[model samples]
Target chain A: MASKKNLVPRRDFIKTSALGLSALSIGLPLNSALATSCGSSGKDKLGIALVGLGNYSKGQLAPSLLETEHCYLSAIVTGTKEKEKEWAKKYNIPKGNIYNYENFDDIASNKDIDIVYIVLPNSMHAEFTIRAAKAGKHVICEKPMAVSVAECKAMIKACDDNNVKLSIGYRLQFDPYHKRIINLSKENTLGSINYVNADFAFTIGDPTQWRLKKDLAGGGALMDVGVYCIQACRYSFGQEPIALRAQAFNSGNEKFKEVNETITWQMEFPDGKISNSTTSYAMSVNSLFVSAQKGKAQLMPSYGYGGIKGFIKDEILEFPKFNQQQAQMDAFALNVKNNTDSIVPGEEGLKDMKVIEAIFKSLEQNGARILI
Target chain B: MASKKNLVPRRDFIKTSALGLSALSIGLPLNSALATSCGSSGKDKLGIALVGLGNYSKGQLAPSLLETEHCYLSAIVTGTKEKEKEWAKKYNIPKGNIYNYENFDDIASNKDIDIVYIVLPNSMHAEFTIRAAKAGKHVICEKPMAVSVAECKAMIKACDDNNVKLSIGYRLQFDPYHKRIINLSKENTLGSINYVNADFAFTIGDPTQWRLKKDLAGGGALMDVGVYCIQACRYSFGQEPIALRAQAFNSGNEKFKEVNETITWQMEFPDGKISNSTTSYAMSVNSLFVSAQKGKAQLMPSYGYGGIKGFIKDEILEFPKFNQQQAQMDAFALNVKNNTDSIVPGEEGLKDMKVIEAIFKSLEQNGARILI
Candidate 1:
């Protein structure tokens, strides 16, 4: 049975989203699914099943799940038995709520788990998200939605056919500083931004890590931290780039034999607004700078999970610090409970993948201008 | 009456520089041109004749001449009679030592002046430097050397033919901060340099100014402040770029109708050490950042007349401030007295002009990579 048993909202969503009738559309007596209070009780808060127990899930997501008002960590799916047992015990999860990857599809019978959060590697995101969608649960897949545009489309289709919601894990969209950046664009405060510069680079360790391999990582730094630069420029300008030129370089390091070590690209938007970005696994630099007609704005150390500070011209932009993961989870949970569309849906991730594909094509042709 | 009447050093210089014999080879009996004393007295210091009294000469160079140990102001040249009279009265210049543009060539008879400093517009650089060479004086042509590579070569040839010393007015070459940057490259403190970023831009004013015209300025910010970004990258890497790609944009501002408002370019050196730069008449940004194998170095507010601060991997680079123009003029004066070649000769300016020509070519081809 689908966790969202009520079918009235699903039918209305289908009509509005223009997804034609599918085999999964079945009628059920509609009841109020919205919660009256946002509390820790199992019935009041949405239950989230984390599909991977990676470092991000262990260090950031699990701790943030404890603090989220609209969501609670109720189950986990891990290949390792030890981690499954460890997480179940730590979070007071029932033995029935824990399952290894082999038995993950049986989650269709678990009515308590309403959402599945896919925190796997770049290539594994599509498989787990599609499996979770087939099991009738809302899916929140981590960034770079999949290895290619085809996989991203398949993931979106599976969620739509299963009558479940799909969202890309874009935590910064909930960040107050990022919201202010969007406001600056909407308000036309800086007056027609002419140039933007964004960079996120760090020296990677462990030559054998999955991120150093193209198969698991898809691309190198461009697929990893480079997406953050792309997101920042888009949010800052509130527009998409039309064409781009990109260059890639490697330092002859054995660690980067299968992937790029550094990549830089210049993008042009409508009306000749331009942006330049650099992402590398060989250096450490993080900044998002914008030059406008009348003033400027900058954020150094911009893409970190926390401690993101910035300035709009002469004014310092300091907001109350909160866990971005928690904010992202709570927002997703509210959308699930209300049967509302997500702001960062699967299409958002697909757009970035398109830009990444164009960047690679430009690199292959010796830094040619590639149209998106 | 070439200023350096002694002929032995000139003949030696010709042999070392590999310049074929020319007509102007007459010489006087050898006498000690080197000064025994360093003081304000007439014979002890090389006398500098200011060729143009623009804002730079009026505000910085003139004051610096007062503090220079080896050079002092003794003559003035201007098209405006009012400025000529004003400068003569302010600096105690005699009527015979002062001349307008029409009478400037007559300075050959005035043995009081040993150096002619060309501080004119971009297009006027070649004319004044060549005339000063014919008038038998060492020439210090301001940065950019001239509007084109051909002009720079002609200036060098004229100075060579007259057997007078020729130096480009690159004041920053005398700065301690710049010296440290060069040392970092030589020492390889940051290991093999991988990436570099430099930018110098400002929102320009006065639409009718010479800087906004194609004829007077040659280009916009590239010819003015963008050269600094190029210089910083060259000094930091100590290697010339082998290839480059460039893009130019204009904001449809009427003032920039004849020139570019902004330009960005990327360059690659022998080992694929890449650099990105931006220059503009539409924004304000100044920085020089380098990312290497071991560490990083940055200088925000990097290129200016004064107050340039920087850091090398967490260590703040603060040194005692001194007048760079004074240091530059004093060093050139010492080169003339000792018959030594200037470190910043016309060849350095010619090299920069060559790179600039390639950048313009790339810009014309829609940011195509051009071999330098």
Candidate 2:
């Protein structure tokens, strides 16, 4: 089992700066700084650009930017000209900010764009984020952070070398109810957590989505919804798993060879607490549960795009409506402006990816217990 | 993996008139008469003889009998004469029906005692149930049906030879909400079952309880609450597991020497569905979830000794409370009168015991996947 002492240390400079700045930032009242910064006359709003305008970018992210006060869509980079024109027209984005895939590097000359969010297919995340960082822009990348641990490491190194902040979009870290559950566990309100039962699944009828292509989506439901359960386990227990045992099922259809239809796994933490988790593309969705000595807390439809609810002792916890994507983007913007570290930084994503790799390996070996 | 074809055919004579007639003579209903006599009193109420005047017997079962119209506590068998006298007086049981453990067999001479309910510790279940059967009385045994597969087989054989009906107290089978989940899964209301997630755990603080003793309790949480989750998995999917993998933690507590304080396991069934289950004495209680292609149904607090509630999609299904122990006793009574096979027969308990054995074996081998 990996000890807490073995964990990678947080970046010393960012940690120090974060502590010092948080005290100063807390004193600034909400919306007061906003008027001084982003008035009609001043270049106050952070100029954000989206690279690789895929389904996630179109459906979730770009729409959220319309409501964000501190950030605005300043540019676009996509391979498809048709989509670029469509998005530009819909959002009233100027033609000067539009660029195709071939001329994306020239975005360095565009002074309007300050942050570049990479929403590409999985395999291209590292390439675009590194290039954007070198072009003097902070980066926000969608998760599974990168396809492998090595890619994650490389992406982190590239961002560090360019002196730009890097954050992975683990939006649940900002979700109010999820945060409440984590805080409750951290305070030992439920005593020491002993077990966690979690699952994420959905029947995906489409066989031609990017999720079915290993070269694009990295893996199957594990990369998509399963990672959320994994992240939830880590954040909820406030620890990393040291060992994992897993079993995976394939659809056996030729079309599904690149991705699994279902996978079930267990992760054991050092305190002898276990997290039992499963993800499937052919089953119904389920809640995420953390069972502790005192009681249990569950979030039904935990990682869904909307209306996440939390329950404790069979009673639902009430919290404000939180747009997780917006919260994540706001955090990224604040980190970029104030030179702060992200709560779910690149390193955290790397740790989850390592565990994900171990689970897949265990499944390949016929459900052997794999030590993390 | 055992095939469906490999299942032994039900012994015809055991299902024929002689066994049926013998069951009816003990006040259980015959299968042929079940439909017409759904709520009718075809036979006189069976006079039950309690073999152990312990906490579970006094607390759960005896109180349930007061409200039960079809069964009556006519006798008592206790090692302690004080308890025997106190219980007989409290329930208006006749002093002639009272017998010490040494004289329990003499109850056969008294025709009033039609059934003997054995609610003893692990090691004593087999002996008493077998003795009760030999005394020509129907037997109702509490769960973990026997300490081992051999012991379970012995109980079944003894009951078969004595021509006495034997029923295991798997009360959930009679529970309306649990039955609804099973029936809905069978009817494909949730579409084809793809996965099942279940857990039963509680913080067991008392180190001196009989449940902590391996000799008396058989195993820890797995033998206690886990049996219920296992039964739920089987009936919810209506199939036996073909293979299993398990891992357990001893938790560094000497009090749980012969059993595990926490255990996590997975079972693969014939239809490619996997049941991921966990049981622990260190964690709090949990629900059981069955995820299918269309939707999921969960029983929150699935195995609690209270009213079971079912959740499907967004709706909760609440059923009328029937005392599980009393309902089980009444089912045994009806089976005796009608001369029918038990819904939770000795063999069904034996099957679960076999799976439990396999889980322990797998845990011993460091979480190796084992075929059932």
Candidate 3:
């Protein structure tokens, strides 16, 4: 449902500048997204209004907006009155710019807020993104775009119909270490990646949370943290998988009775490149390892808020750590101001959702192989 | 075909000793196998003849034999006459004690050779083991005991019929770091293990070698280095997997036409514990990661000749490196001299073959679930 023209230009972004190529070897600060030019159409920064004011918005996006050059936090939409007052006092927003979820659609009339950043729960992403798109505002929805492929398609259709750009909040795509990984993968520097072993997991507390509720979460660990592993493999290989087989496991824990505690899946690509990934809510693990014909490249603690380290063969990947969320927002703002294509468009998230749907289907069939 | 009574006593060995239990915490030198007693029946050290002068015999087993406290390199069997004379002079073995592969059965009259260690190719293991047993000598066969389950059964029956102890050359059982892992698993130090992710791969050279031939090596990477991953998972969990799903990948490389270039498999245990493992001939990767209820335990570059490191939670496992092959030979020698049950008996290798057979069956069925 996404605009084909918008998705087609993504390959150009992958061909990053010489600065990014040098950053891969020198371990310097990578700001290739800032250097990207689609023939700039605007001179002023864009204003962003964050929806849902959740932990991610409060802990990461709000703080990152303070440092982002192309975007600034101008407004907020929240249901809680305390957060509205606390964030208003903390960020110094004007009274006219404040709105609650009930009056969020009125944001269409406000010209100051150019973008709506959805930082909501798993199942709430599609509703907020579609609403923001219908309101004629560009949207930046967090990862897993939505819980299902149908929701993803609907969100993309709304944005396409409204003629507003939509980007997924895949912060690692703007990271320096991950930029190096992407370059290495695209360049075949390690000789055609043969296998990928990725894992992202952590112990989730609060069994009463929405993430444990199947209706609110749509799925379990695979829908939550497993999306990151899927993203890592796709970006590392620069291709989509052709087939998948997945298994969901339960360890007799009462807390995960309604959701999966652990899930592992294998993906087979067209060129015989295979990937194995696991996402769990019962353990702590964060790593992305790629094996190629010539050598190996890996990142431990790869997908996180900060402190992502990488190693290719004998050399350690050195890059200055920056706020990934800031980079992501800046890139999205540039695309909005210039009217250029998004690096991580709605189609990207939809592709991942398709894989997730296939994984769930495989699990339902007791780990039968499902063609994607 | 293996003596069931001999395999039954292995549970006693798993209980280890107070010294070994303390060694797990203190990271001290582990000599538990040497401390095991069944009653001394002989007083002298055993004499060992290493069959085949390949890389393992030349690089590891022969050198370890010189340092073994309960075994000495009394002779050797080699098809090449040049290696026979070279080993005879280097180890001070008399000419009469040496024999070629064709006349290996003549060792029945030689009192100097008490044990024959089979270090030949994959397909030759059963043949040499059975011949050594017939010659009234104890046998120690290298891993992947034989090409098929039937071969393993026949070899075990031959040893049982001959009434000579038959052990498998599984050296990690004598390692201090692995001993600590075993203790952690059995004691449930990290709570019941929920998942294991293990990989052992290295870029293999020489396309013309027998390892690339199906009839010679039985399988490619799975039979070569992948056996170690299977061993690591089973030992880490102290249980056999009840079912498995396996996938074999080929990257259109002509060198691997007769065998698999890469293979990945997932195993499900009775308690709902799961494991994911990979073995490849086109990449460099060595790791074993375990996720349990309370914490994680791992080892990078876990399986090799030496320099195995381990980590559990916040602690770094530290232990002095001793020759693993020496410990394995010495332990077997002690079992022979004291007339005790071998810890790593032929049955241990047979059990692994059952898993491998299941893996191949699953692969033949295109990764369908195969119950073991």
Candidate 4:
């Protein structure tokens, strides 16, 4: 069981900001004040510790955390003591905050850390997140929440039991440009969304990486990048897909023996609109597009960590240098302190996993239509 | 065989103001100059005829011809006599030029017409185009060239044997913006084409339209709209796709089978880069996008008739409102008189048809990878 003392004090953080003052003037409750402050504040430095120093953690997460105002590097936890020491020295992190995997659970005893961001291999996300929850810390976990839907549910349950806020790192949901597009769609700027075309692919140069290993990364590009397209479809249309059909291809290689390198699928919404989507590790990368009767919304280089732009009706609406990972961390922090539901909560992640599972099932059956 | 004398010289009707001369002097060749100045200009207006008076011809081709320098509306061959009379009166056309389906072949002996534009159903395109060639007249046909590869080849042979130029109306090839995009791509403005994301789709409300009839429209949305994406991909990359994989869905009524409403596909280039592309009738219309290592070139609403805009690395490069259809017609006239190849000739249309055939085959096999 987790203690309340180690968990993020949402009300306290809210009281510490201008948002808290505004909330106080509005006669709102303390939790709502925290929520409003979370949305309003620019960036506040919150000490963050990253667990599982993988490639994404080092390349994307670390750089993004540095750019975030509401978060700063406080500590790191890794199974290898050498890596922990090397990273601590490189980032000039304090020695007291460093920990090996064996003593990772004791991280809750540390007083400086406000959040634990998990960027480990897929299978470890659930275990580490659950342990962090029990240690009375808010947790931000990377996508495909868990290896299985069952694992995701268990992790969510563990967090709830410990009374610690849990958020899945679906960074695009917090992306300002992407969020604006969603708002435009909801406003019927493009009329009704009658169709959607989404794709995410890249040529993977390394085969020995954990992403290619099914046990560690769960699945291939579909799990890694395809989930972004799926979430985009749902958010753009503001609904879950009612039915799905998919097809997959494998080039008969041991590198992708346990996962798929390519997947193409379609989803049918209740409004008779269908979304056509594709994702692959063996192809190129592109932005996802949504077309309605009036106009369209698209994110150029949509899923990348850099150079993301939003367009509507052939005009650019949002061009911001956004750090998706940092924005995600800040949002999670605010949600914890404010007792608010995460924009991309555990339930949303679970639903996306469900859609992913259904897609795999349809592909196995030769693209037979599967009702969601 | 059609005699050159039987063809109306399209240059005699030029109503050139001083503005027109200035426009022509700026390196833009007028279609009328090619007909009169290059060859022996005829004194009489060349009698022109339209075979199919559908939405496209009525809305685009007819209006463009009315503004043409050399072409004249001498005859109309339509299934609906009411529409024929309405069009004849609107254009002040002589009633002797009118003919129905039964009497259409008799116009071969009539001296009034020199050319016929076939704007019929996809399956009927080849039949009418070949018939017009045999009837001693030049032929202008709308795209998807024909329903199949065999049909396109046959149309090409018919026009060749008849000593006439068979032009496929690929209007985008004539649009200055698309041309600039292709030229820039070849010029390496965006570096070597590493990736492409092209899409064309629009919601179709009427399920019983010719587009929904598979036999008439060939496939579904891929035949009607996806052809644009395919052509754009070829032109933007400056090469043919070496391999392709495709997936399609029929979300509409299963019994109303003619065209697929949605399609997702990928094309692999020889340079080890692949394009992720999609087209759907169930969604809104979209433009073509190309991304290279250096930057990206994108056309929002790429296939629309007007208000087309192109972008390079977020800077607006071209915004043109000239009629794409009229530009195509003028170019075809120039090619005919100057003995030059068309920007979008029979060969290009044939290549696109070949790719379309492969996409259909791959879809039937559950998105099996096919080498183009």
Between candidates 2 and 4, the lDDT winner: 2
Candidate 2 per-residue C-alpha lDDT over A1-372 given as tens digits, one digit per residue, 9 for 90 to 100: 112212223553443344344434656433333322221123456778888888888998898888776678888888987887799899888998898777787665455676888888888888888888666467888887878888888888877765566789888888887888778667888778777777888777778878889999888889888888898888888888998888776646565688887888888887678888888887777578887767778888788767887787667888767677887887777755655566677888789899889988997787787898
- Per-residue lDDT of A257-323 in model 3, one digit per residue for the tens? 8889888888988777789898988777888988777777888879988888778877798787689
User: lDDT score of model 2?
Assistant: 0.77
Error of 2 at A5 (Å): 22
Candidate 4 per-residue lDDT over residues A1-372, each given as its tens digit: 224534456654543465456546666565544532343233355567889887877888887777775677888988876787778877888988887778888775454566788888888988998898776567788888887888888888987766566778888887777877678667877777777778787768788988999889888998888998888899888878998877676655567787897787878887577787778787566677777777767787787776786677768766558777888887776665555766676777788888888898887786777888
Of the candidates shown, which would achieve the greatest DockQ relative to the real structure?
2
Best prediction by TM-score: 2
Assess each model's interface with DockQ, reporting 2 decimals per model: 0.37, 0.45, 0.34, 0.22
Across B198-218, the per-residue lDDT of candidate 3 in tens digits comes to 899887898998889999899
Tell me the TM-score of model 3. 0.85
Clashing pairs in 4: A10-A337, A44-A70, A46-A70, A195-B283, B8-B46, B10-B70, B214-B258, B220-B259, B220-B260
lDDT of 1 by residue, A1-372 (tens): 233333445454443232222212322112212111111123578889998898999999999999999988989988888897789879999998998889999776565678899988899999999999887678899987888888988998898777677889889898887777777789999898777889889989999988888899899999989998888888888899888888777768788899998888888887777788889998788888888877888777688898997788878999887699999999988887766677788888888888899999998887777999
Q: Candidate 1: deviation at residue B113, Å? A: 2.1
Error of 2 at B344 (Å): 1.9
Q: Sorted on DockQ, highest at the top, how do the candidates line up?
A: 2, 1, 3, 4
Error of 1 at B209 (Å): 3.1
| RMSD from true fold, candidate 3 | 10.6
Where is the poorest 10-residue window by lDDT in model 1 chain B? B31-40
**How high is the lDDT of residue B343 in model 3?**
82
Candidate 2 residue runs with Cα over 4 Å from true position? A1-42, B1-43
Off by over 4 Å in 3: A1-45, A252-254, A318-321, B1-44, B317-321
